[model samples]
Target: MRVPVSSKIGVSNPYRSWKSATDPSPGNYSMGVDPNGGQQIVIWGKEGRRWRSGQWNLQFFIGIPYMSNNVSSFHGFKISLPDETGTMYITYKPPTQDLFRFVISWEGKERQLKWDDDKKKWLPLQSEPDPDNKCELYNYCGNYATCDRSNSRRICNCLEGFKPKFKDQWDQENWSAGCERKIQLQCQSTNRTSRENGKPDGFKKLKCTKLPDLATLLPSEENTEACGKRCLENCQCKAYAFVTGIRCMVWTGDLIDMQHFQQFQQAGNFLFFYRLHHSELDGGRKISNLVIVIICVVVASFLVASLWLLWRYKKKVKVSSMPCCKDKDVAIFDVSKSKRKEFSADLSGPSDILIDENQDNGPELPIFNFGVVAAATKNFYEGNKLGQGGFGAVYKGELPGGKEIAVKRLSGNSGQGLEEFKTEIILIARLQHRNLVRLLGCSIQGEEKLLIYEYMPNKSLDNLLFDATKKAELGWRSRLDIIEGIARGLLYLHRDSRLRIIHRDLKASNILLDAEMNPKISDFGMARMFQGNQNEANTVRVVGTYGYMSPEYAMEGLFSVKSDVYSFGVLLLEIVSGQRNTTFRSSDHTSLLSYAWRLWSEDKAMDLVDPSIRDTCSPNEVLKCIHIGMLCVQDSAVHRPTMAAVVLLLESETPTLPMPTKPTYTFLRSAIEEEYIGDAQEIVSSNDLTVTLQY
Candidate 1:
């Protein structure tokens, strides 16, 4: 198969399948770069992630150990991440490029075919998931569990010092939850109330295997010893692996998608160390009966004393800051009674498709009582209100510590705000990024649902981007920084974070600005989660603003990461041109997109720059952003570039980027206001479920 390659994502990177066996249409499968970008590839199916090509070890995909046995020149496959000088590309040369064919089959399998002139047909040379071993499937053994096909009867097994999370499920051959530690570590962890033990943690080494997915790249280490030492010192680090091409990589949280390999136990062939309790590393030592009895007696006495203290503490906590029901969704925390209030969620719900995600995510979210929130916002005085939007009104407040906070108060009457309130509480609490707004905590009392965030002194992007007096304060360079920040945040949502998120509503109003004028993407209530390798999903009830919605999502309720990209493109153009997507009107164009495209086609792209920064803006930088924005707002989702690509445009290996086709023309604001409502108030009402569609 012939394919164009690049180190950067998006352009000439992905290979998608036909709709069906005979019908030629786009299917739900694609072979593309790994979203996590660990120098590997991933194949996504209609369901989720189907398979991965393992990690790159300079020679080949380390996951494909058998590749070492093949002496064919097929090893010409090479990939390099783009650098400042544009030295990035992914190139592959088969023995006969013209005769070889590559395809993502309609049946959701990636295939490499060789044309046989003798037989007058194409012959398949390779396929993923191995077909023969069901264990090859993605996360078949779940977290902290490895699938070993060598064990025909039971392929799934937990590592030493671990046991199945759910014994009943494991007994029934369901290892999705995988395993849990048999004993607690000395340092801080979910199960541990605090750092109690004095002993240090240790590591257990394993032989060749596919490294766990989503490994975060770390700085270069002199050797595996240094890598191990660095990971071992960090409390969050769970495992560490060192590869040839890619140096040190450390995995935090639960490790998933690990497999067993038969490669020889050598220096660089997939030897990874998993973290465990130091006691678990004892070399099968036996203790004397008398010594064991003495230790047991001492531990019993300590437990008795600890239990009494724990009971008294729980009694005080249960009186106020906890929920009445074990499976309750809301907790009436009384922050006024204490400086810190704890979250009471014995349940999970649908935000990014999983509620209360993990121990590291849920319990960590703080809870502010209604009394404290009310006092901070001066009983929600009219003057304290920052702004009112689809979700509700945001109020500026301050804690007793003099820390500023922005409280998003869900409208009691608007049923729409309730879901959004819960969503923001779940999604933002788990997400950690500078470009993304930080969610401090939540407040729930009776009908009040309030989400507390670190207050942005400069307010939202729309506050300055559209304000006549404040617009010029953000220069051309600052505007570019805002664009890049938003892109980074969007990229994190889609590819970097553990959760694959799609922000359905991404616009100027939703972009918040810090005191430093740095941009942070906010308002995740309309966001949805994409599980595993899931590319797209359909919904009947559509949400979000009109002009920002993607064509497919607005008309058919189909949404994905690309939907956010389209919205971002619109926002990007607005940042550059200082014009709203829906309100722009020119002599020959009705919307901002059409006007920008018209200028670009006429070689007057410079005319699209916002008047305020035109004098100070670098023409080259401005032109590059406009071109990228045009690519993002493409009418067809297939043609739209991924956020990862947009973020990496600076490092593009090619000197000249591809020219973007004419974008899908946006709506005429005059017609919208005439047909729907007279003002912006009615269009973006407090009830967020307002869906305006064309055709």
Candidate 2:
């Protein structure tokens, strides 16, 4: 339902939730636009202020780091400035969405839940005051301090240039007194900052942390650098943060309810600058990370030198002592004669991928130098950026031989770590398939890691499949070809390959398209390999997109070949309908799977075909594909057909297909669908324009 939210003084109609799921009565919590100030939503509890949906900086609330990168922008949230009557309103209207509502949970957790028609339940979408994150509570850490849930010992810690006001209480686990300044500011003292060559007070830079509350927008300072100057001139300004889509915000009053959230995607990161005395800032200069890197290098070099010298000295002494044995006909044997070996290179990109003993497994993956890659991509210019994800950006480049390549660069702040980088190179190098994306090589220089792949001119399938106009280019034949290619590719990985592999992340975006529009499965970072007859494996860490993940994999961390089949089914239905399975909803169905099943069971499977495809697609083939998709998405893993069988059915029309049972898709069993809602949890939908089309 599209409802109007206003912050008018007299007629503000806020959505105050019930006491619990079962109890439908006025509760102690409420949620609505911030009537006090700013374009934000506030969740109020009985104790007064609870949590806030950080200021809306045109893109998304600064409160949610994930939203800082436009992760929530696709949800179609729009807010209008105060009108002539001094009233503002915000609305939620995605082009295609289901019935959803806002509610303050019994525990004062502001939640956004979507209605699931099939299950007759409300699926949670967004929530504030995350019960798991204790720092979300209003002013929990007090003023001048930050909370870090990741810190196992203590949640609250004083910011730099400050110390706990009451040391006795603080040691006893009480930080209620907050913190006190360690040194007087330049403006606060008659003889200020004598300790650091009379340097002025400076700001301590903090990255990817929640900016404190009660920020006053500074429209005068347009440039971020100018914003810092403006803050320095003002004695009242305690902290400052520059939000991309919004004006610079300076906190003049006490900074409250700050938190140190985990490092986010590059685009999603925001820097918070807290005021500090010059002495604490090393002679009032910006803290250089390069200095830290250099210091570590020096220490490491010293240690290496010491160890080498010690080894050489000991070897020389041993040699001098073994003079008599050397003449006694000594025989030596090589210790490096073993055939089977494993590469143990870490944080070095594709250098970890070693060649197999047998030549049939193919040559070792090529390792491109960083200089070559940087030059090819024009020094990694913004214009050359093909796309940006949690792992930095993808650049389109060309080699000296005129071969085009797609380079995936890893961001230091990215969620993709060394394990994922190694996994991609090791897994892709060992497997070979026409329908699988080829890993040309990689570049590892210093902290920079990049993976080079055969460039796909058409990019990802989602580019065409989701766009209204671009989708027209994907005719029925092209869509069918993509489907068949993906099926055969999955078949090769699951059965024909030397190692039985499961492409955990099998979504439209992961399926790349070449010049011919043929689909090749890409991105094996989250993939798992099964050894001789090992059907499945369980892990505590579950990775993959939520809508496409199988029930067992998403809930119990249990994954196998069947998990890929389930993902394949989701992709199949999406391809047929030209709609996102995650957001698609019908009058009587919660998702595309149930909707298609309902139509199939009623002998009206032809209705499920995308209108664009209906004119050109053969009725029999479309129906058969729908039948196979339903079979692949069955409730149980055993009910789904293997990739081998799926390939046979797609390739051969003569083979009779089995009748599909009713398919039931479930949401994430965990309370938090995914703790970190990075690029993985979101659909990568690129828009031609930034304008929000108001309805």
Candidate 3:
């Protein structure tokens, strides 16, 4: 069945029916490249062409949308042209040196399979025309229609601005007749010169879509806008799209074989479909503007009334009755006469008081005196120094009542400045949870900005988890409790709290431990609040420690709750193995995640438990935790479980956990340190290295 280098290999109708297990005869189906040098690989049925592998685009077969450059990188797929001998061939170099083959079965299913050493059988890596989504069968929806597998009722649907050509057939679940444009294109009747006189057509942006078949690449146009103008000038142009690698692509005929993907499923490509009329866009814009105007008026009126009420209340209230004045244990002062004058001269403002008062309707934080804080810390001496963080040096301080506190004194040269200080106040002041650090109050005078928090006697989890001598204190049960506590805190931030939050810098050191050894998540500097149901966001300035950051957040500046989940996964693995994800190395495994994954795949997951806790650790519990950790570190953010799911899996034994894929292995300690260390300053020195960048 091997075709010569210069010859064509194909399947024909008569060869497809040979069903004998040991039969050397061909079946009723035939497949091969067209000998006329069309480059497309076609499978022929008894009737006509059944399927096709669209012309090669150097990296992949254009017909298969998911066969991307990454697939080539993983499988080493390539199409080689013939030499003077006049032959061409398709080949692949497997990721591993495993026995492999490409075959077309009796059912006409083309598949690429590899021998599975463990299973002792051939396992198909890829099969053409997925059975579940029959839309992949070429032009399943016919002309001017798109196919979406996510659509439950029917896989085929008319493209936007179109309607089914045959309404009866559409209702009957027959889409062979496809669809037609609802409004006639303006260019149909008007000439290019006359088109400028009336409302011109425009493009409707289709986010994350597979472009239709028969796309013409416009190389002369450097950008999309230019290509758009070119398409608009042409009377027959139906659609256009701007692709990163291919640049401008235009379609003149009906759009076919189109597919739409959700935001999470999309790689990078999008299709900009042309609209037949300007009214299609104008109607939506008008409604949006009206809504904006109404919202503005309501918000403005509410703000004015609120301000008037506050002003009237302030006139009748006495300063002696203020909450800050009533608390005897808390001291409020301006620190020094010079600092008071400076604060009054520059920083004192009504907005500051308003923000502090309105934050989640929480209690107003008492402003501490700089002098009193300095005295408690012995004039900010080195002896009282507890630790240094991204913000500045933290010192151990005791109030007059012998109440201990950790004072985070902001440094002028530190990456975290007044903005982060305010963020910490707004977030921590309102959050009240057992596993969350408590912010007592803050002090702002002259150039000093400090945050006071209830001191944790045992310091942070990293202090115990990574220290060989101290790690033994954390038995299996204790570590499991710590993991559960952290999960609860994260769950609260993501779902239970009034405001959804993403703790971008979740890590071992940021998790503080109380005297009872309960884990408390600290450091709200990099936390982001998501209003309503907003789950993810993007930022150009990425802030967080290396090793603990998720792949999306680290490489693309995209983050969500799943980002925190990824960090938690790394932390969980570290807690179980008593090893640092970034620093741990062995003869066979370069990183802790790699090592854990190897052990899991080899059914040696119990071996990953730390020797200190091995005697007490339950084999099933440890294995389950490892499995959950691996799920959390999956490459795709969508694949990572929500914090709620993680918590349930940890607490209940009723739910069966899904199998985890291999963890993303892009991170290597040496390479990451070399690339990022020079650009960032070391903030916290512990078992884990935390770095912060000055923007």
Winning model by TM-score = 1
Q: Higher-lDDT candidate among 1 and 3?
A: 1
lDDT string, candidate 1, 1-695, tens digits: 33333435433436877765555667767886653536666778868888776776666776665564452545678765656754455567776655776677765666777888889999877533365465667888989999888887678999888999999568646578899999877786554544554557889998867788888887568678899988988989999988777788899878888888655534345578999887788663478999999999999999998788766675344323333324222233433223332333422434346523433234245577677788789999999999987557999997665668999988866545555666666678789887998887887677788889889889999888888888998888699889998999999999989877888889998899887777889988877877767899998778877777888887788998899999998899999998887666556655678788888889999899989988657677788888888889888899998988888893352336687876644534435454565333334422336454565
Specify the poorest-scoring 10-residue window by lDDT in model 2.
331-340
Error of 2 at 217 (Å): 86
**Per-model TM values vs. the true structure:** 0.52, 0.47, 0.48
User: lDDT by residue for model 2 over 545-638, one digit each (tens)?
Assistant: 7678787776677889999999999999899989877666455555677778778889998788888877656666777788889888887999
Task: After the best TM-score superposition of candidate 3, give how far the Cα of residue 532 lies from its true spot, in angstroms.
Answer: 0.7
Q: Alpha-carbon error at 362 in model 1, in Å?
A: 5.6
Instruction: Give lDDT per model, in order.
Output: 0.75, 0.73, 0.71
- lDDT, model 2: 0.73
User: In model 1, where is the ten-residue run with the lowest total lDDT?
Assistant: 335-344
Positional deviation of residue 168's Cα in model 1 after best superposition, in angstroms? 45
How many steric clashes between backbone atoms does each model show? 7, 0, 13
TM-score, cand. 1: 0.52
For residues 1-695, what per-residue lDDT tens digits would candidate 3 score against the true structure?
32333334433222253432245376556766543322455666566565666545455554565565245333566556676666656566766778887676654556677899999999877544464356656677778887788888678888778899989557645577899988776667447665557677777777545566666777678888888898988978888876654567788888876665534223344356665666555463456788999999999999999888766664332222124334433444423334334434443322322332343432245568676688778888898898877678989898775768899898987787665666677677778777898887788777899888989888989889989999999988799999999999999998888767788889898899877788999999778777665767887677877777887877678999999999999999999999877677566655678788888889999789999988556666788899999999887899999999999999874469998877644335434544555423432333223333322
Cα RMSDs of all predictions? Answer: 16.0, 22.8, 22.3
lDDT of 2 at 180: 83
Candidate with more favorable, higher lDDT: 2 or 3: 2
Q: Is candidate 1 or candidate 2 better by TM-score?
A: 1
Model 2, runs deviating above 4 Å: 1-344, 347-363, 667-695
